[model samples]
Target: MAATTAVQTKKKKDRTFVTTMKRLLKNKLAIFGLIIILLQVVMAIAAPVITIHSPFKQNLAQSELPLFSEGHFLGTDNFGRDLWSRIVYGARISLLVGITAVGLGLAGGVTLGLIAGYYRRLDGIIMRIVDLLFAFPGILLAMLIIAVLGTSLVNVAIAISIWSIPTCARIVRGSVLSVKKQEYVQAMKSLGASDFRILVKHILPNCSAPIIVFATMRMATAILSTASLSYLGLGAQPPTPEWGAMISQGQDFMWTSPHMTIVPGIAIMLIVFAFNVVGDGLRDALDPNMNLNQ
Candidate 1:
């Protein structure tokens, strides 16, 4: 009977996962967002094969060339570096920062969240730490961390991850508190299972939906924040081909070559927008009230 019940529970979860995917696919904006994200990933991965020129090499003779003027399709930067190649390569850094930040935040936050939610004794301490982080705005916190750590692509990602941890922890803590009261969780508790086992095998799985949705949204914010930091000279320093660094470099030549700013700016906006839309879609998909038929 116990094995039968466990099998039934697994089947139910599988059905729920399937339903969520169906609803997500039905969302037109979400589908578009997924496409944009996939394309960016492809662009980042294929940067070497797709790029037309060396992102770092400069040609003084072709300096500040306008878009579509000649061999330089997106045109050259102020130092005569290829804009298209720079943009292609920049995708690698931007995507790397976003993914790494989110991964780090999720790892730390989920552990802290599970501890706080499962152990009443630790809740106050963990929550107090989270509250302290919440005292400052995320960007301000990120800036402070970056200042202390110094600037680079990896450091920028770490800073953003630090700021993002509290939000994920809070979200997961809430989900855990709510999930703990469910019948299934109570069933596990009534059994001879240990607290860790119940929390890991039972509670955490149920909380994954919210965690996933929040992570998606947070990824967009992470990308934007990292770009802002790079623009301000705190991330992926000179000649690195990062989007924000590229935009910063092109600001002076904006009037002479608007494509310089326009190209990378659009890339940043599109990727961020994609993540936001996908997050929204996931939120709806995960909602129990969502009517897939509707």
Candidate 2:
């Protein structure tokens, strides 16, 4: 009987996944966004093979070459580094930092949220701290963190992760508050399930839909924040092939070698757009009110 019930549960999950995907794919803009994201992933993974020139290597004689110039597909920067190579490699940093920061934020935020929602005594204390963090503007908070932590890519990631925690905590807390009141959770408690087991094995899983949607949308914000920090010289430093730093460097030569800034700018814009659209699609697709067959 238990085996049959387990099989039925698995099948239900499978069907839900299929339905979600079908709904998501029905959105043309989301499909376009997914393609862009996939391309960025491929470019990040195959950067070495995709670019002929070294992103860091310089040839002063070839500096500031225009677009589609000989041997330089996207042209050379002020330092004669390949623009295409730098953009391609920069994808790795953007994706890595965004994902790593979001994962860390989710870890910390979800813990606090679960504890706060499940244990009412801690809710007031936890939420006060979260509210305090939320009072500050995100970029200013991130800048303050970077100032205290000092500059570096890793520091930027840490700062962004910290900045992300309050919002994630609030989201998780709300979801947890709603899910905990459900009948299944009450049944689990009556069955003598441990608090940890009830939270992790049951409550958390039910709260995941919103978490997933938040994570997807947060990726865009994370990438944009990383770029902004880098542009301000608080993140990735000179010659690191970071997109924001590249744009910062290219700003001086805007009139002469605008391609340097434009290329990275376009890359950043497209990536953020892709994540945003995909996130929107996921939110809609995950809605129970959405007609699965439609």
Candidate 3:
């Protein structure tokens, strides 16, 4: 009877924790954001299947076709490329940039943050560098990097990753500082656990919540940044179906076929907005103090 009671008590605690998490997810705005994010992901994945026109194929005769015209649903650009098709393909560039840049930033930042947080003497030096990077606006820093590296997809990713690093590092460092002072960490030290083991097992797991939230937010920023770079001719080159490049290519035809520019612009706005909403929701959902109403 005693053993059964103990098992039931443990299960109850676990259920309570899960219920709390569910309550956080119950926020309608967060749920909506999640849905939109998922929808975008699906659209990106299904881009090829959804569109018949190759994003690169151009029809000068049908140039600047407006929405709902002829065969083109969203219309055609100055180059007569299908707007809908271009937008679908553009998703690949945006997702690629967002994921790659954030992944690089997260990996580098977390590693540096852990090292600095664990070693008291190194903290000051590492944080100073982060602070210096943070002083400049991320966009401006990306611009500078792009200018120096020259216009290319790889350069855009690198520039955005550079801007992302400081913020990610700061977040991870703060989380690590908090976790390092915990009793478990102290116990680990007393047990003569290796530094790597303590950091990987005891510290990193507890710091994940904040890191995840930051990463989500950074993804939105990365997408926007990539677009901005492409707008400036520093990203995915001509004939490539990138949203920013599409907008740039369509600008001249804006007076004739506004849908050319407007469609791609809307796509960028929607993607960035969706990501921001989802990121905000994730932050709220991950808050430990939140409770689900029964």
Candidate 4:
């Protein structure tokens, strides 16, 4: 009977996922966003193969070349580094930091949320910590962590992850609170199921909808925040092909070689847009009240 019930549950979950995906695909904005994200991912992965020239090698002679110049499709920065190569490589950095930071933040947030929501005795203490973190503005909080950890790409990711923790925990805690009140959760408690088993198997599965939405939206925030930090000279440093850093480098040549800054700025905007629209789509698709048929 237990095995049969488990099989039914698995089938139901699969059906739900398929339905959500079908709904998501029906959103035109989401399809466009996915295309943009896919293109960026392809460019990032094929950086070495697709790039016309080295992103870092400087050539004073070719410095500040106009866009569409031979051997330099997108032109060159002040240092004569290939704008196309730098932009392509920058995608790798942006995506890496965004994904890593969010992954870490989600892991920490989910654990704390599970403990706090499951154990009434721990909820107060855990929530207090989350509240304290939330007291600071997100960017300010990230800056403070970066100040202590010192500036570096790795440190930037860590700081952003720390900054992300409070919001993720709050979201997860709310979801958990609601989920744990469900009849199934109460039944699990009375059936001698371990706290770990109940939380991980039953409670977390039910809470996945909100968590998925949060993660998608948070990816947009994470990538944008990374660019902001790097632009402020606190994230990826000089010589790094990070889009924010590239923009910073090109600011001086904005008049003569505007593509240096404009190209990378556009890259950032497109990626952020991609994530935001996809997130919006996921939220709508995952909402139980949203009719999939419509």
Candidate 5:
């Protein structure tokens, strides 16, 4: 009976923590961004059902039509591809690239950062390499990488991941440094806990909040970087409904059909904005000193 009561009490405490988190995340800007991001996800998932025309199917007669034409609502592009369909499908490309690149960076950076932070002797060598990568602007670094790897979806993802690694590693190192000084971590060290056990069981868990917030922010940056690469003809090759590729295709006809460029541009802006808002919200919500009821 005592064990059951204790288990229930622990569960209640966890639920309280989750509820407090939800209350903090109710910030208007954050909620609005979450809604917009959710809508885009749904639109991407329902692309086929949402659009009447195929994203790649062309109709020369309907080419360059304006928004709200007789049949097309968002109109057609230079190749007579449906603007709405292309935009809907393009969400998939942006989201996939953002998530995949950030996931790769998070995996590699966190491992390296934890090791470098826990081992002082390794810090200098690891950080110097990070600094070297950081010397160039992220977009330029990605461009150079893509140029070497040759343009392709996989190559673009790899480039973005590489560019993202240094930032993630730096953020994780900062978090780990703060966590290592906590009394609990020191107490574990005094008890003769193995370095690996202390780090994995004590330090890393405490430092996860900042790492999560940074990852969310990095996702937005990754998306923009991938788009830039695609714009330069290094990602999501022709006939693919990538937002950046769509923008590149529409650039030549910017005067005649501004919607082609503007629509995709808007999509990219909204997605990046959504991620930034969510990241900011998470940072605030995860702060232990923050009082939601106040």
Candidate 6:
């Protein structure tokens, strides 16, 4: 009997997974976004083999070459650095900063969020701290953190993560508040389950959808913030092949070498747009009320 029950439970879980996947697949925008993300990831990973020229290599004599100029398909920057190569390589830093910072923020934010939502006594204090962080603009907060921590790729990632943490915490706390009152959670409480068990086993699982959606959306935000900081000389430094820094360097020569500005700017926009649409699709798919299937 117990074996039959276990088998049935497994089947049910598998069915639920299948259903969720089906829903996601039905979302055209989500599929489009997924493709964009996958392409960027591939581009980032295969940067060296695919890049036309060494992103850091200088060719002062060939500087500001126009687009579609023989070997330089995307042209060269003001420093004669290959714009195509830099853009391709720049994907690495942008995606890395986005994914790493979001992952870090998820960790700290999940902990604080779970604690604040589950523990009444700590909720106010934690949320107040979150509020304080939010009072400053998100990018401003990131810049402030970068200013204090000084600049580098890792420090930039840390700064972005710190900025992201409060947002994550607030999203999770709201989701948790709704989840904790669910029937199973109350049943767990009534059956003498510890708060930790109820939270970890019941509450958090139910909150996963919103957390996932929020995380996806925040990745784009983090990327933009990282790029902005890099542009402002507070993130990746010179010759780093970072998109924002590339834009910063290109801005001065925008008239003669517009490709320098346009290429990187387009890259950032495509990434952010992809993630935003994916987040929207996920939100729609996850919400039972919104039918993705026509």
lDDT values for all models: 0.91, 0.93, 0.85, 0.90, 0.86, 0.88
lDDT (Cα, tens digit) per residue for candidate 2, span 28-88: 9999999999999999999989989888999999999999998998999988998989999
Of 2 and 3, the candidate ranking higher by lDDT: 2
Predicted candidate 6 versus true structure: per-residue lDDT over 65-103, tens digit per residue: 998998998899888888889889899999988999999
Per-residue lDDT of model 1, residues 112-196, tens digit only: 9999998889999999999999999988898899899998889999999999899999999999999998987888778878998
lDDT of 4 by residue, 128-159 (tens): 99999989999999999999999998998899
Error of 1 at 175 (Å): 0.5
- Stretch of 10 with least lDDT, candidate 2: 285-294
Off-target runs (Cα >4 Å) in candidate 3 are: 1-17, 291-294
TM-score result, candidate 6: 0.93
Q: Which digits, one per residue and each the tens of the lDDT, describe model 3 over residues 165-272?
A: 888888888889888999878988998999999999779988888888888888888998898889878898998899898888778877777787788898888878
**Which one wins by TM-score: 1 or 3?**
1
Q: Is candidate 3 or candidate 4 better by TM-score?
A: 4
What's each prediction's TM-score?
Answer: 0.96, 0.97, 0.92, 0.97, 0.91, 0.93
Model 1, runs deviating above 4 Å: 291-294
Q: Please report the TM-score between candidate 1 and the true structure.
A: 0.96
Error of 4 at 109 (Å): 0.9
lDDT of 5 by residue, 78-116 (tens): 778888888898998888888899999888888878988
Superposition-based RMSD of candidate 6 using all C-alpha atoms, in angstroms: 2.0
**Which residue window of length 10 is worst by lDDT in model 6?**
285-294
The clash count for each model shown is: 0, 0, 1, 0, 0, 0
TM-score of 2: 0.97
Clashes of 2: 0
* Residue-level lDDT for 202 in candidate 6: 78
